[model samples]
Target: MEPLPSLEVIKLDEAPLAFTLATLFEPSSVLSQKLVPQLHEKLKSSPSPPTSYGELIGLAIDQVRTWNVDLQAKFISGHPRIGETKNLSMLSAKEQGANSDRPTVQPTPPKVLARLAHLNAYYERCYPKLVYIVFVNGRSRAEIVRVLEDHLGLAHSLSIDEPALETADPVDVGSQKWLDELERAVRDVGLIAKSRLIALNVA
Candidate 1:
């Protein structure tokens, strides 16, 4: 459980993930704040401009996969039920009163799977892409990966290896300062998007 990298001041590439990270960490930016209105307006008008806000949000979600290595490792390491060290004793106790030979018991893997599914559904409803950054604490990457895998299913090609998790660090003060600036930007952009959306509806 090493200190995770400081996400605050990392130089973001010119990708959608960068924007998404900016928006998530800095939701109160003037730009983000203004985006709502702008989006409203555009939606109202017949000829709306093609906006990249949605794509940016989606990109932010994509970057979350990078940290998945740590997340998955933690999840898997912690949850013995999914891996080798499963707690069959607990299961047996729960099924003690039932038909011992034909007991109806649910394994930890399925429960973990269900939890992951719930997380995915929650994120999808909140935004377009899957949002797992907010949950990055000092937990093991395996744990996080397992949940994501269960929810997203095998179809998702995201990987969370041990090496990736080992390389994580906490967000530094400098990074935090930069993130604050980014947050402001996101707010500003969001505001604009909102405004456009409103305007469009009115039109």
Candidate 2:
């Protein structure tokens, strides 16, 4: 397989399978050890590989959702946190519109960042081993905060309705709301990846 291509080398239709994987996901050994190989096998058996990277990423997300909970968590958690201000990948930095080179751009306010950080911490506590991941998709920090707040409220309501989830196994908890959140996160991962691919000017 070709060495993982730099961001400059990833053109959806032309790059090798590993290039697409690296472009779509953060660096995770599980991706190299599992997801990439699985996708390669899938492409081999298909009548033809997907013409668009977006479709390929959708299939990857579907495969992730079918894995065992631990594996799913590993894959899902590879995504960056919403409202993160630093240490973003080139793709994530572009996706979040953070650290722009244009001088006219204003950064998210410190107060808003603080609130998001607090909410992120609370959210992780609410759902162990899960990070708050959203597509951001050009939404403002305040708007993203509202989404996070709404999610926390929903998680709280679900916990109240199914208190047993608190004591259930961390990896195997069967709460519908938690499971739904996981599925949503995986879906967002696809959305983010596809949008990034589009931004790459994939042909």
Candidate 3:
């Protein structure tokens, strides 16, 4: 993969900042709108923008989490569900083993996909507005399904409700197990971005 231009070049324009954020996270006009200005201000605040990808990503993560929980949940939900089979962002397609840049990998079997879909529904029902997001990182569908099953075991299958998230303490938005799932999804977003950053910089 072609390496992104140096940070020095990227900080020169909001366009590059938007592109970089979309590449690292999923492409979302809402997310870009919310993040690009903060990133630009951050870039301007320092004489030197973050000298490393890690610091830049840290800034991105911190900014996202500082938003209200509803927005944060929505942003995390923007990620394609695990085992999703359609309209994947390039980074997601590559990580899930189905990018045009790589040699063709066999399509996941319909049966396995069906199982994943069922599990995805269960997971979403268990925690409203939060989709199951994993790094995938090259795991097979079967393996991912197993992971989902294990996660479901930990989660309480509850009647999904529209909680007053805006006024409620963000930390208590869900059961502790549910919160753990959200935290894991957030961590995986950073992990996925780090992996993508590494791959893009590869020699």
Candidate 4:
């Protein structure tokens, strides 16, 4: 196992919803068995059921869109001067000569900051579960372990890199290696766990 690149926590505002939704909705070889079941449960508790797949997807899409909108609103309110400062020092010699020799002091707009704060609050409230996916790009096992311990708050029961496992092809050697490493890590923490390659693939 190698230490992977630091996983970036994409802010809700920064995410491109259309791209994310496209990827999420595309059919993959690794589908979560619980996805449909969980969706069904949620729908049963809801006031109304979606009439079609399009409607269902639309509902999900709308939720994300609404969140972004709310975040943008809050950001705008909190930061009002986001785009008004000019710096003479950083400009080209010709431009600098036209202005004073002082650095620009453009502050974040109050409205934008407010919107960002709102989005942060919404994400924290909605998704308490912080999902982390690690990708190995040729680093040492010790470094990876250290990073996992320091930043991710890994626990005995917490699944590591679950999405990777879910998306891995069963016949691929790399996937098998990934499974082996994950299982080893789990067992090292004294948990009795089974790999999907064994349980799902075999079954």
Tell me each candidate's TM-score: 0.19, 0.77, 0.81, 0.18
Q: By lDDT, who's the top model here?
A: 3
Q: Against the hidden true structure, what lDDT does model 3 obtain? A: 0.70
Error of 1 at 15 (Å): 38
Stretches of candidate 1 off by over 4 Å are 1-157, 161-163, 174-177, 188-200
Pick out the ten consecutive residues of candidate 3 with the lowest summed lDDT.
156-165
State which candidate has the highest TM-score. Answer: 3
RMSD of each: 18.8, 6.5, 6.1, 22.8
TM-score, prediction 3: 0.81
Q: Write the per-residue lDDT of candidate 3 for residues 1-203, one digit (tens) a residue.
A: 44566678767787777777777887776677788788878887777678877778778888887777677777787678877768876667767764435633448777777777777776666677688888877777767877777766533222232222232222235677666767788788888888887657631
Q: How far out, in Å, is residue 137 in model 3?
A: 2.3
Predicted structure 4, TM vs. truth: 0.18
As for candidate 3, its clashing pairs are: none
Q: Give the per-residue lDDT of model 1 (tens digit) for 13-81.
A: 223323333323333232233333333333344243224444333333233223333332222122122
What tens-digit string does per-residue lDDT give for candidate 4 at 69-177?
3332221222111121232112111111212232233333344334333332332222222122232222223333444434333332223332232332332223544
Residue-level error in angstroms, candidate 3, position 83: 1.4
